[model samples]
Every structure is written in C-alpha cells, then in structure tokens.
Target: MFSRRTVLTGMAAGLFAPYFHDVYAQSSALPARLVLVLECNGVYPRALLSTGTRAALGGRANTSDRLFWDAYKDTPLVREGDNLASAISLGPLAESAGKIDLVNRSAVLLGLSNLIAGGGHSSGTGGLSCAVNGAGATVDAVIAPRLRRGAPFDVLRLGTSSARVSIVYETCALGPRKPAGIIVNPSLAFDSTFGSLLGGSTNGRDRKMLFDFALADSRKALAEFKGNSNERLKLERYVSSLESLRTREDQLTGMADRVRPYLPVAPKDNPLLTGAGSPPDSLKWFEAQFQIATAALLGGLTNTVVLATGTSGFDVAYGPDVSDVARHNLQHGLDAGQNWEKVAEVTRRHVQLVANLARTLAATPEVGASGSMLDHTAIIFMSDNGEQHHSTSREWPKLVVGGNALGLKTDGRTVVYPKYDAPRNRQVSNLFNTLGHAFGDADFNTFGQEGSTRIAPGPLSELYG
Candidate 1:
C-alpha cells in the first residue's frame, strides 16, 4: 500500500516533471503573466460603447433597447480606431491621469454571454470558474501552475469588501469542491507575503514554530505506525501538506534580499477597519491590494493574481463621492434617484486603478527580458455579473490590456459578438480558453462547464495573433 506522501512526492517529481524542470532551468526571458480584476454589480454596457460604436449600432443610448441588441444579432462588430478614448468608461484606461498611453494596447470585448454561471447580482465564483455556483477550478487556478516560474506563490488572490471581512472564498477555486481564499485585509496580506523580508513578525515566527511542531509530531507518528490503514493514509496526506507549506515558507524566507528592493510602503492601519460594524475604507484597501499585487509580481513572488472588489456577497460602500450611498442601492440604479453618474464614477475608479497598475508596469523594466514588464503581462478587467444589476447573463464585457508577448491581438480593438440569443454567440469560457492557449496550453480548449450554451470548442481565434 503506498502512503499518501509517497504518491504526492512521486506526482510532484514525475507528473509535473517539465514544470519542475522549468522552475530550476528557466532562461533569462520572462514568461507570460496574467492579472484578473473582477468587480460586482456588472458593467454598464453603454459606458463601454464609444461614439463610433454607438453610431454603428444606430446611436442607441439604452443598451437594453431591443433595437440595440438586434443591431449586432446577426453580424459581429469588430473595430480598431482612434475613437476608443472617447468612451466614458475607457477614458482612464486609454489615457490615465498619469498620461500612460494604453489605448493602443487595449481591447474592449462585448456581447459574450454566460448563462451556465447563473448570474444575478454576482456570479459568485462562476464568473471566473465558468461553473454553476462555482463548482470547478477557476481559470486563474488552472493556468497558474502552467505559468509558474518558481515563484513562492503560483497564484496570489487579493480582494477588498464593503464589510470588514479579513478573507473571502467566493471568487477563485482550486478544483471541484475546492474554493480558494482571497486575503481581504491589506495588513495581513503584506505580513504574509513580505513579512519574512522584514525579519519576520511575531505572528510569522509563531506560525513557523507551530508548523515545525506539527511536522515533528507527524514524523513520530509515521515512525510508530506499522500498518498502512486509512488513518495512516490520512496522516501521510496531512504531513505532506505541512511539508509543502514549510518548503514554501523556507523559499520565501531565503529570498529576503531579492524581495526587499521591490517591497511596497506598508499600508498604515485605518480606524475604519476596526469594528465589525464600521464601514470599510474601500479606496484605501483597493490601493493597498493593488500595490501588494504589483510588488509581488515584480519581486518574482507570484505570476498570476486575482484582484477582486465587491464580488458576490460583498456590498462595499464605494469611495469618496459615493461613500454615503449604499452600493446595493447604486446597483439598483438608485444613486440619488435614477441617475447612474455615481455608479459610473465607481466604475471609473476601478479602471483608474488598473490604469495605474499598467502605467507602473510599463515604466519598470522586466527582470530578465528586453521590454517593459507590461509588455509581457496580460491585464483583464471584467464584471463579475453580466451586463446589469440583477443580470440575466445575456451579455458580458471585458477590458483587456497588454500581453503583446503572448500573441493577443489587443491593439485598440473593439469586438462585439452577436447577441446572446444568436446561434453564433460565444461564452466567457471561450475567453479563458483563449488565455489558456496564450499561456501555451495548446490543447486546453474545453476549459469550463459545457452545455447547450457553449457555442463551440476552442479559443476565440480572433483574439490571438
């Protein structure tokens, strides 16, 4: 009877042989990286439509207008032009306040539907996983290991909620019945990722000591147990998990010198994060999480990250202008009685933050490559729900930036597929499949849950170079 530890060891050494080899023998050139930014309450579809696109669709203002949906029902609309910057929601990404020009490297995707995800206010993990009620591994988790380059973390999940929750598991997942955790507290996230660089905090030391004690105890049990019973198998699995965790910790601790140069200025604690009933500082948390993710990417700590905000079950009060308004109310189109300007501002803030990330990455040189870090990375901003609050999962829009090195044809393009009811309509799973292909997973065409909603197999060929 083989022990669980032995099985895991063999799998790591043999099943993932090529990945392990790449980790130790990677070349100076940087591998492709991915960043996914997901937000709740859906994106206002009209906000993404530029003047030219609006004109092409017969100058429709209301996206819900039957005429608007019919305009692109039979034929898809694909345009790459100078008018992308004119879109209200895309202005910040096109030309940030900091003057970074990402428009040429960006693409706006529209008309993709995902009914299998069961969208309403939010799709829970379904938005990324493309499984009903988040019943499978998300795209981030699926691709992280394949793209891994010996980073301490293959994928880092970070998020901020309207509530004072420290962590959440509603977004990404590892596999079926396995949900991943997103660090909601910035301080805790920093302590976990960069704490070792600052000589290790008391909490870190205590955790390490506990791990050591558990490992010692487990080894003693392994020595004493003579039979390969179910109990012993469980013990072996537990020990293997502990050992893997310890190895990861040791790797992070050994990289102090390498991580120090890229460390972010640690976030100062805010009083608003104290009480359970106190409103969360949404803006502050967003900024801190973005900074930490960027630092982690630059320091070679993680290659894939999911930065989420107001996902399902998270009704965070937004930043300054809309701080007083209930996020849920805004989602219902009730910000100061039927005006959506506040909602637009909230969406714009998320875009501006993404723009800042793109800008910083564009200015920084790749660690072991010729061009800037932004050139080798793919950044995606998407709505967790579909096109509107209480969505019917009819249309989903995405804003994609960078990834020139990964064969993505994102050169100021605007792609509007046929309507959801159209026979040729595609789903969000196709996008994930496309990304899987871009990451060099050539045969990763069937990515998510399949049913009648699936238009066809394979990646969106139009997205690739």
Candidate 2:
C-alpha cells in the first residue's frame, strides 16, 4: 500500500542510507556515545564568543546594532596554545584562576547556517531532523540504532519545559511525520526509566494503561481510515507516536535486569516530587533530567541521549533572572525593562549546565576504555534556532565537548566556517554528517537536505580529519 510508513522508510534509505556492514564492522572497543543538549528560541552569537575572539574579528565589544552586525563575520574562539579565552557563556567552565580548564578537551563551531530548517519561533523537528518542520527522521533516530551496541533503549529523550507539560514532541522525529516525545515531567520520566525496576510506580502503570489504550485506538482508527491523503497523514503520525512509546516501554521491561545496576537515584528534593500539583520551571527540571541522563549513559541503558530545555513552545521563563518574560519576549533581545543582560543570563545558564555535564563525564572513567568517559563520549550543545530570537537561519553557534575516541579533532580548536553569504559556506547538515562519520559510518556523507544544489556534500573534514 501507499502508506506514510513505507514512503518514509524508503526515503530515509535513499537520503541517508546506513551501510550495515560499515556500521557493524567495529573492533571490540567500546562504542563512542552521544549526548545532544538543545535549548529553545535562539542563542545570540556574541554571548558565546570570547572577548579576544571578537576583537580578532573586529567585532565591537558592546551589544549595540553595530556589534550585532559584526557577529556575522568569521569569528573564532581565541586560543593560546591549548587554552581558550573566557567567554561569558563559558565562564562557569573556567577554574578559580579564570582559565577554561576544559579548553584542551573542547571545540567551538561558528558561522554554520540552517536555512533549510526554516527557523522562526523554533525549528521544531527540523532542529535535529535537519528537514523542514517535522519531516524526515532526526539525526538521533538515524544514528541511535546504528550506534546502540546492547543498550536497552535506542535513545533516551528527556526534556524540560517552561510550563508543566508532561511531554513535548517538537524537536525530534523517527521519520516523516513521526515526532518523538520529550518527557517534560521529571517525576514521570524517572518512573518511565527506573520505575520498572521496583515493580513500576502507580503513575507509570496508569500512564501505561492510557498509552496502550491510545495505541490500540489509533491502530483501529488507522485500519478503518478510508480518508483523504491529509487525514491519512495525520493518522499515520498519531499511530507512529503511540508505537514509539510502546516500543520504549517494551524495551524498558525487557532490559530491566540490565538497566537496574546503573540506575540513578531519584532527584533529591525535586519540586516535581513534592506533590505540589504543578510542574516546576525549566531550571529545576533541567537538573533532574541531567541526573537521569547521566545514569542512563553510565548504566548502559542507552548510548545516545537528547536533553532539551525551553523548546517546542515549552516554558522559557526561568526565574526572576529573566524577569519571567518567557520565550517570545526574550527573543526580542530585551526584557520588559530593556535588560539585555537577562538574555545573556539565560544563554549562560544553558552553557553552564552543559559544562557541568562535561565535567562529570570527564571525572568518571570509561568501564571498558582506557580514558575517562568524556574521551569516548560527545556532548553537543547548541540552540534549536539560529542566532537571535527571531532567527534568520544564519550563523549557528555550536559547542562540543570530548569525543576524542570518535575521531573528533576538538582539542582546543575553534573552527569558523565562512559566513552564510559566502559561496564556500558550510551548513549544519555537514556537521551532522561529520558526526555520522565519527560514529563509524565512513561513507555517510548525505545527511538531511545536503543533496540539494545549494548545500555542499560530505562531512566536515576539518572536524574529523
């Protein structure tokens, strides 16, 4: 039949086909891991560049219109041998002497654009899928199954919202029209991940019942559907979402024994666990999700994970720091009182959280590897949209930590591709292709919409060569 599932599968195989032999032909060494951390709206490029790097690019030091225009130029991270100069967003990663101790193990990427994603308000599924809006399988979906050695789950998708939503499905997808869910409620996420070990929690059991019923209903409805193509597409997406949840639940049950030993303790003093009858802000949820993700990675539950905050129409009002302006207003580059620092504060907080996760991984040793877990893992931090709140899909800034085991040349390096207007400029799809190459797919060059004449083909040789 001409169903969406078959079409999507075929398209994926054609667009970003994975070679089974190459993906599986790896030595006995432990597989490299991936953790993608994404924030919502947009990230100002200036917030991420160090003073010296900006100066080197002749960028004005202030946040005025002149400085905003200067951000489009090629600006690299200021480096001294093996150390990077401090940027406000990365200041938390620095030591007491104000030196970034993690510079030698990190890399900063700039000037890559994603016009194909159609950025505004948010990129939705396009952020990870690299396809417009909600089309195509996201990078996580394409890479997770290939990289998952023996993990119970294919990918761990956790998220935090400004609101008290239980789940949001804006940033990930399995295939065309198949959106992946981000568990926004920490309490529910904990129950989903670890609850089965203790015979399952009440919430988990109740939620499972609802999920099963919905899945059954969707399948029945799909079978009965003799509607138009648009209606059929909607039904297919709904069924796909339910099926994805069921698959995760089944995996959790089957892998309970394997996942039990590495279970992380439930978040302590978490507001979500306080029975407050309301969800806490993104700050509290971000910390909880991080704790859960660390456990999932270290425990061998999953080698690929995605942690999100303030994405997909979720809450962006972090605290009094941002003046509770939410995402739309904050994207204006001003709070209610014209406080630009508030915007920088939110961006810095995201970077701070990412840095802490990197430090934690660096501190722990890989169970079957010679170096620390960080050496074998890649932690990527980026904004869902491009630069600024109302993003123009130009000059996306990215930061990556570790992944030395995965052939990443991120040792205190700052790679700034040409601006989007330049003929030789690179796209985000190239970066994704580079990651696919790092994860053992040697010939995996065509990712996302790179087949288009507008985009260049192949992985970024500057990153992995």
Best by TM-score: 1
All models, RMSD in angstroms: 8.2, 9.1
Q: What tens-digit string does per-residue lDDT give for candidate 1 at 1-465?
A: 222222222110000000111122222134778999987768867767777877776635435332256667466678876467677777786654557788888888888888888878878878888888768888887887776777767677887876456777777777787777877777777665555455546755766888899999999999899886998898887888788777877886677555555454444533333322246656656766777677666666778888888753557865454556667766665445644776666777888888877876777666565677778889998888778778887888888888877788878888888888898888899999888878877787888896756788778866775
Predicted candidate 2 versus true structure: per-residue lDDT over 140-221, tens digit per residue: 8788867688655667787776654677778888788878787776767765455545555675577678889999899999
Off by over 4 Å in 1: 1-30, 59-67, 96-98, 199-207, 222-233, 261-265, 269-277, 335-338
**TM-score versus the correct structure, for each prediction:** 0.87, 0.78
Error of 2 at 313 (Å): 1.0
Error (Å) of candidate 2 at residue 408 is: 1.0
